[model samples]
Target: MDSSVSSLTQYGSFRKPTFPLSNSCRHKPRRWPLALRFIKGAIHHVILVPILLHTLFTCIIVYIHINIQTLSVPANIVPSLSIVVGLMLVFRNSSSYDRYWGGRTNLQSIGTSVRNLTRSFLVCGPDRDEADRKETEKVVKVLVGMLYAVKNHLRSTWGHGYLLPEYKGLLPEGMYGFESEGVGLVLELAVVVERYIKRGVDRGAFNAPQSSMLSSQLNALVDAYGKMETIKLTPIPIAHQIHQKQVLALYCCVLPFCLVDELGWLCVPIICLICFMLYGIEGIGEEIEDPFGSDKNDIKIDAIIEDLRQEVSVLLDSWRRGGEEYTI
Candidate 1:
């Protein structure tokens, strides 16, 4: 029937292992107008508004040119003004890109954490648990659960403060977590797993070397989580952002006037196009600055979190059932 109703499902059962499902599923992106996507979201710089200003000035200049009592002004001065505006636009666009890239680099760190954690969990597990091995098997599945939790936490895709429908009921209820708190929880989970390993070693269920290696791996995962949190929360200073936006707006408004003297009536449409392009680009950069937002261009955090939840559900369920039986 419907996947969303009960909030959990396996891709299969019995003879085959199934892919887990999650309730935090996301829908496809909503399409925005081409102009709005580029101008409003891509170029938060509002670059086009300045161009509108320029267009206004150009319109004024055109009116003046057509009715001028004399063509006495030097032609070379107008060209110089055009050059200056162009240089300013170039600088503004370049700076916007720098901000966007900085955010992207931060998100990439999550991939590193995922790889390191996954390998460590798989490698450090006790292999000799065939006797009363059910508990050990369950813990192994917890690693899968942990992976999904970490992914959902980073994405901010949660329901009632839990990772999602599949994971929510399993975690401690009533506790809400932001990025910083989520990292703390992840570290705590590592500690829980470490304790289990120590217990296993003391009882001759696991080896000493494996326990130590697992500890180091978990620690590395914790470190990566911290770094990601730092990037997600920290942003460029407010004053700089404000100044950049204001300067871009003012520049666009005066662009049309500068062009009017050179292109005559043609400056109207040309200036409008220029303004739209610059503004759109700047808007895109602004949205990208915080790729975690709900904006159209923002990263699909909900979807990522949902996938994590689903994958984790598979791991946890398979573990609880005793991994030996999970043939897939």
Candidate 2:
């Protein structure tokens, strides 16, 4: 038992420290009470503006109907309006969700391609000589750099802020030919990888089939990059967005008028609840539509990038150990 414990301790000493998972499934739970949650979201500038306007309109309609007896909008009008507004909100949320899901899917594709290409380079490529090993290490660094660059590209952030500290020295000194630093860096890395492949083939380190597979993986990464760019640059139709907002605004502004005659003093709370629900739904769609941002609801891009880095590190370590060869 003592010998076993000693061995375990020795093994533990060489083990890497484990990090807490940061993906969606293991994210910190939100445990705020219902009242707190309501108050927290209620005070947001977006919701507050609509709530204040709703309250004002509710009070005005109540006074006018009870004291002056001058206004009465038919209650039947609400059913049709509610149906139309509900449908529009549904469409809006669905379209936004499509974009959010597409962004996530594309990012995953990029991550998969990065891992595949990195593994192919480190395990299958030529690492026979000291010079060959050095070149392979350089290529591995470039693979890691491409993942970070893609993350920054999606977020529309350029310059050094988004770069991984460990891989910074591996990248070129300045942005590549393109004006956009993130994209330019990725393109530059691709050029380097392609040239490395050509040199490997010329030196007979990798034959045609092996070189072709590596090139295909690189091509997959680029294809995923283009798809992500399309999602980022193209937005839902402006007309649809504008029209939905206009409808929502009109519905909220006129809502109290319809309720005041029936609910009297109770109309205020009812209107507040209805406005909150509708506004909250709309807000969710807006927040998620561009999932690459820093918002709580946005995709956890930093976490994803960190996972990619860890994956590449593991592959590099395996190569260094001369582990069982990995076939493409």
What's the lDDT for candidate 1?
0.54
Give the alpha carbon lDDT tens digit for every residue of 141-168 in model 1. 4444455555555566544333355544
lDDT for each of the candidates? Answer: 0.54, 0.77
Reference-based TM-score, model 1: 0.62
Off by over 4 Å in 2: 1-15, 19-30, 33-45, 161-167, 172-177, 180-183, 323-328
- Tens digits of per-residue lDDT for model 2, 1-328: 8866885585457657755343434556669865677544343556778877887888888888889885658888888889989999999899889988988898888888888877777766776788888788888877878887777777766655234464565564553446353245577788988999999898887899989988998898888878878878888789988998999989987777777878997998898888888988888777777788866677887788777776676567657766453212
- TM-score, each model? 0.62, 0.86
In the order shown, what is each candidate's alpha-carbon RMSD? 7.2, 3.7
Best by lDDT: 2
